[model samples]
Target: MVELSGKSDPFQHSFPNAVFYIPALIVVSAVAFFGYKLYKSLTEKDRKREEKLKAKQAKKKK
Candidate 1:
């Protein structure tokens, strides 16, 4: 015959879940910040390039 302990499952008492979530949250936050910065910089460059091309075209018509 086997007997079960009255205590809860062993996993419930193990290391806290925050140990994994905290580092993962930090990494994800860093990636998002850098990704947004890169996106803004690329878009700004494209906008400036487009404006220069338009100005050149307008000058040719005058």
Candidate 2:
């Protein structure tokens, strides 16, 4: 006689091991996006400052 009450199947109630990878991937992608945005903003600010300085120098030469 097979006993159904005492034995439990390992595959029937198993939790997924790779479930946390999804959130980790999302966090890493967000950090990369923010870092790229910061770099772009800083580069744009520096470029604008350079243009202003050049304009000032040209005015001084006039």
lDDT of 2 by residue, 1-62 (tens): 22334346553443354566778899999999999999999999999999999999999999
> What is every candidate's alpha-carbon RMSD to the true fold?
7.0, 7.5
| Lowest lDDT block of 10, candidate 1 | 1-10
Instruction: Provide the lDDT at 39 for model 1.
Output: 100
Best by TM-score: 1
Residue pairs that clash (backbone atoms under 3 angstroms), model 2:
none
Best by lDDT: 1
Backbone collisions counted per model? 0, 0
